[model samples]
Target: MTELNISTTAGVFDATAAGPAEGRPVLLLHGFPQTRLAWDRQITALAAHGYRVVAPDQRGYSPGARPERPDDYRISLLVDDVLAITEELGWTTFDLVGHDWGGAVAWWTADAHPGRIRTLTVVSTPHPGALADALRTDEDQRARSHYMLDWRETPKTENDMLADGADSLRALYAGKVPQASADAYIRQLSQPGALTAALNWYRSGRPRHAIGTIDVPTLYIWSTDDAAFGPAAAQGTEQWVNAPYRFEALRGISHWIPEEAPETLNRLLIEHLQTHEEH
Candidate 1:
């Protein structure tokens, strides 16, 4: 894997590039409180499979890319960060993969730049519209998402996440990610201003307008143990895709699908990419 510092309009983002340069490009985006390191397992797998994988320490997560203002972390700008990374790589179009908050940005990216994404693979996050609907009408979803509200409303969210030697943060990935992987995430977010920037993603609030149907061939994966998202939203995702779509549900896995279940994730990703390989 090659670690690179990519310059974008926002700032320089730290990223990792792997696989043969001439291979099909695949852009991977990670979620809140974690850097591109979150893709460690899958990146190696995809690269070995001959996919050019580019995973970025998305805006706010990278020190140079961190913007102080909460608005800077809005959905559009988050999507722009992905676009800028792809542009920097000279990829006009690529297979897209995202997890957690990264999955949210991936959804908006596919919606806004339909032609630029050849295939969309979202892990553990549902379509914005489906999530919004769940938040608005489903009591269970509302309860499940209480952490988001706390992150948005409480000024101490950062401290709370970092206190007790980041015990709170460690709990998030209990059985989901190995200790080393969880430690890596904690170390990144534990940096000064890192936790704040990550929290800004939540403080930025939901998208003003819903991200609608994606036209590209898409794959959505969800684990039954995810605490933040529930079954209703996951099941409701089918309604938002206008093209070929496949859904895979992992009965016992947790929200940290990429880390907890890399083999399964890689198999699904490889199949999805091959099935929709651009001729």
Candidate 2:
């Protein structure tokens, strides 16, 4: 893999990329507390399959892109960052894959720029409207998402997560990700202002624009053991997607699908990408 510094409106983003220059372009976005490394396995798999893969450490996670204001991490800006990176890469259209918080941003990007995104794949995060409704009316979803409250608490959340050498943050993987992999993620987040910038994604409240229907071909992957995103929201995700959509549930898998279930995710991604091959 080649390390790259991608310039965006917010700042230069740190990214890792692979595959041939002439291959089909694919953009992978990582979620909270993790860097572009989260897509390492898929990057290798997809690149080998002849797809140009690029994974960017979004917004606050990249040292150069870290903005101090909580509001700067809003979803709209986050979406803009992805578009900017792709535009800089000279990809007029590309396949997009995102996990956790990244999935949320991907949803918004696909909705806002339908013609620019060829195919959309989201892992472990439901559509914004599905999630918003569940968070408001579903007790189970609200209970599972209670951690968002703590994450929005600024210094307190950072202190608690950083305490005992970020043991709390490491626990998030729940034994699904290998120790070395988890360690890499923790180290990146341990950097000064890194953790807070990641949490800012949560503090930036959901905007009404995020509730629209996605018109591009889409795929939603959810694991049964995900602690934060519940099935109720996953089931309702289709309601917000007006385009062709497929939902896959990984039974007995944890939230860290990219690491723990890379093979399955890769296969699904290849199938999705092939089905909607850029013609």
Candidate 3:
């Protein structure tokens, strides 16, 4: 894979890219606390299959794109960045995939611009509306998401994550992610203002980013053991999709689905992408 700096209307974003330039375009967005490295396995696998893949260090995660004010990290702006990045890549329409926080952005983008998204694949995170529904109706889900409260306390979280050599931050991976990849994530987030900027994703704007049902052919992958989400959230996700939709539950997997279950996730992703072509 080759590293690249992609210029968008917002700013230059550091990205990891691969595959033939003429191949079908695929844009992958990484979640918080991680960089474009999160998609390493998928990038190589997809490039071999003749699909051009690019995963950007979205928003606050990229040094060149990080903005100081929390308001700059709004979901509308994040979605704008995605649209702008695709425009910069010369893709009129493309397959989109996202994980964790990235998945939230993906859901909103596909909903807001279904005509431009040939397909949607999201891992580990449910649609924001579904999550909101669960948080209100499902006590278990609300309890699970309580850590988001701590994340909003940026000063405390930064200190807790940085103190003791960022033991708390490293523990987020729970040893599920590869050591090298996890180390790279820790190093990037440990940089000055990086952790706060990353946390801004949680603190940005209001409760939900997505407003309507999505019509794009969609795939939602949820792991049974995901601590931050529950069955209630996953069950409601399909209802938010107005078009062809598939929901897969990995019985023993965790929230870090891409890292912990790359092979499974990749197989599902490739099949979904193949099932839906850019038009």
Candidate 4:
């Protein structure tokens, strides 16, 4: 993989790319507490399949890209950052895939700027509307998402997560994320201002938005055992997608769907991309 620094309206974003320079571009966005390296496996596989994959340490995660004000990390700004990076790379339109918080951003980007996205694949996150609905009506979802309250209200959420050598953060990924990857995530979150900036994603705006229907072909992957989201939220996602959509529930899997099931995720993504092309 080649490391790159792309200029965006917010700042310079650290990115990684692979595959032929002229191949179809696929932008992969990572979730909270994780870096672009989270997509390392899929990046290699997709590149081998003739895709030019670009993964960026988005917004707050990238040292130079992080903003001081919480408002700067709003979803609109996050979407703009992705578009700016894509424009910087001369890609007017590209396929998008995101996991966790990245998935939320991807959904918003595809919905608000349909012209910039050709296809969308999201892992382990529900559509905004679905999330909003769940947060309001689903007691289980609200209970599961209790951590968000702490993240938003507590002043020391970051320090507490990082203290004790990030033992709590590491535990969240136990049995799901590989040891090396988990350590890398902890190290990234440990960086000065990194965790705070990331948490800003949750704090910058309303916790959820009314579900907006997306017109682009899309795929939603949810694990049966994801702790952060409940089945109601996952199943209700289809209501907000007006375009062709596929929902896959990986039984017995945890929230780390891409990492825990890389091959399955890669196959699904490749199939969706190829099927979209054929259609």
lDDT of 3 by residue, 1-279 (tens): 888898876888999899999999999999977888989999988999999999999999989899988889989999999999999889998999999999999998997888899899999899888999999999999999999887998698899998888888889888888989988999999998999999998888793433899988999999999988899999999888888999999999888888899999899999998887744
Name the better of 1 and 4 by TM-score: 1
Clash pairs for candidate 1: none
Best by lDDT: 2
lDDT of each: 0.90, 0.91, 0.90, 0.90
By how many angstroms RMSD does model 1 differ from the true structure? Answer: 1.1
Scored against the true structure, residue 236 in model 4 reaches a CA lDDT of 94
Tens-digit lDDT track for model 4 on 84-167?
999999998899999999999899999888988999999999998898899999999999999987888545887678788988
| Lowest lDDT block of 10, candidate 3 | 202-211
Alpha carbon lDDT of residue 233, candidate 2? 98
Q: How do the residues 169-192 of candidate 1 rate in per-residue lDDT, one tens digit apiece?
A: 888886677788788889988888
Which stretches of model 4 miss by more than 4 angstroms? 207-211
TM-score of each: 0.98, 0.97, 0.97, 0.97
